[model samples]
Target: MTIRFRPSEPTDAAALLRVWRRAVDGTHHFLSAQDRVAIDPLVADYVGSTALRIAEKDGEVVAFMGVTGQNVDSLFIDPAAHGSGIGRSLVDEVARPTTVEVNEQNEGAVAFYKRLGFEVTSRSETDEDGRPYPLLHMRRD
Candidate 1:
């Protein structure tokens, strides 16, 4: 499959949300039931507010990344498309990304970032909203 990247449009919101939900449901084993409920609305808000550059394959949005300043605010790939190098392309497209926050419980994601030369620079005991899920602050080195 050939994957391409493009700036997201307003009409892409619904597809982006679907990709987010599918990705989180498939990978977020660490989120509690309550945290899951709380994060959905947060995700919805993010979908509308962030400028996303999306990865499309076969004319369908399969992944996306949100960058704000030097931070990678979000990167979610369709669960079915995991291992396809789309995420790597998104990161590469950024001239130089210095920081990213990752859920500490997601081993695959932690390893993925590490493979791309990011190392944990700090840790948070809870997520941004004070949820119990821990986070690792990573920096490209």
Candidate 2:
């Protein structure tokens, strides 16, 4: 599939949240079941407010990255499109050479970021919201 990216629009919020939830559910095995349940309803709100770039494949949003200045606040690929280069492409389109915080427990994501030339710059014992999930801060090399 030929993936392309465009700035997100107000109407894309719902679909973006769907893609985000799918990606999170598929990859966030470190999140407890209760965490998933608690987080689900917040997805739409977050997507609606973020400055995002949408990754489209065949005219459908297959992934998205939320960016602010040079920082990537969030990146999610539809579970159906995992391993299809969507995540990397979104990062390239929106936040290549940028900074990001990845969950340290998500080994695949850490490796993926490394493959894209991001190196660990620091780490935090809790997430931005003080969640228990540790975060690895990285910057492109």
Candidate 3:
């Protein structure tokens, strides 16, 4: 699989949205169907920012991410493409120290972040749906 990361352009919106929905489904936990209806617009808005990233595999977009708060906001990979290092590439490309929040229930993600050198700075609550989410701030370690 040929994987590459690039800044998002306005013309990339539709493909990016498809990647968002797929990346959400891969986890099969965070983004419920209702969550898409409610949160997609927020994703759309996040994409409008200058920090969005699109991950392409074999000439097709397989993942995407948004960086904010000096951290990665949304990082999603196609369910079929997990473990491909695309996610880590998104984080590796992070220009500064950053943080990522992993739902306490998502052990895999928590481990992934830890393996990638993110430390547990604190746990946080997510306002997106008013849930108590755990957060980890990751810097080069």
Candidate 4:
């Protein structure tokens, strides 16, 4: 697949949100139904507000990531695009973040970050939104 990377535009919000939803559904089975419902609008808002790096394949958005300085705020790849290295490329080439947070229950995510040279530095009992899902704070070292 030929993947292109570019800065997100205002028109990309809907596609990015679609990628986010599909990715989360594919990987985040641990989330409670209620929590998922509550988080959807928040994610939609975040998609519109954050500046993102988008990965497009054949002119279709397949993944996107958000970064601020040395921190990776978000990364999501469409479920159909999983295992394609798109997420890895986004993290390594686009975000290149020194710090990231992963849901502790998402073992695949934790392992993915570890493979990218991140080590867990701490843990939190709740997510950034104070939800019950735990988070693993990681830093590249």
Which candidate would rank higher by TM-score, 2 or 4?
4
Candidate whose TM-score is highest = 1
lDDT of 4: 0.89
Question: Once model 2 is optimally superposed onto the true structure by TM-score, how far is the C-alpha of residue 64 displaced, in angstroms?
Answer: 0.4
lDDT of 4 by residue, 1-141 (tens): 688999998899899889989999999999999998998999898888888999999899999999888788898889898888888888886344489999999998999999989999999999988988999999984
* Comparing 2 and 4 on lDDT, the stronger one: 4
Runs of candidate 1 with Cα error greater than 4 angstroms are: none
Q: How well does model 3 score by local distance difference test?
A: 0.72
Clashes of 1: 0
Each model's lDDT comes to 0.89, 0.86, 0.72, 0.89
TM per candidate comes to 0.95, 0.90, 0.80, 0.94
**Candidate ordering by TM-score (highest first):** 1, 4, 2, 3
Backbone clashes in model 4, listed as residue pairs = none
Model 4 weakest lDDT span, ten residues long: 89-98
Clash pairs, model 3 backbone: none
- lDDT per residue for candidate 1 within 14-127, as digits (tens), equals 899999999999999888888788788878888877789999998999999999877888999998999989999898776674799999999889999999999999999988
Off by over 4 Å in 4: 94-97
**What tens-digit string does per-residue lDDT give for candidate 3 at 85-111?**
888888887766777666665677778
User: What is the Cα-based lDDT of residue 88 in candidate 2?
Assistant: 80
Q: Which one wins by lDDT: 1 or 2?
A: 1
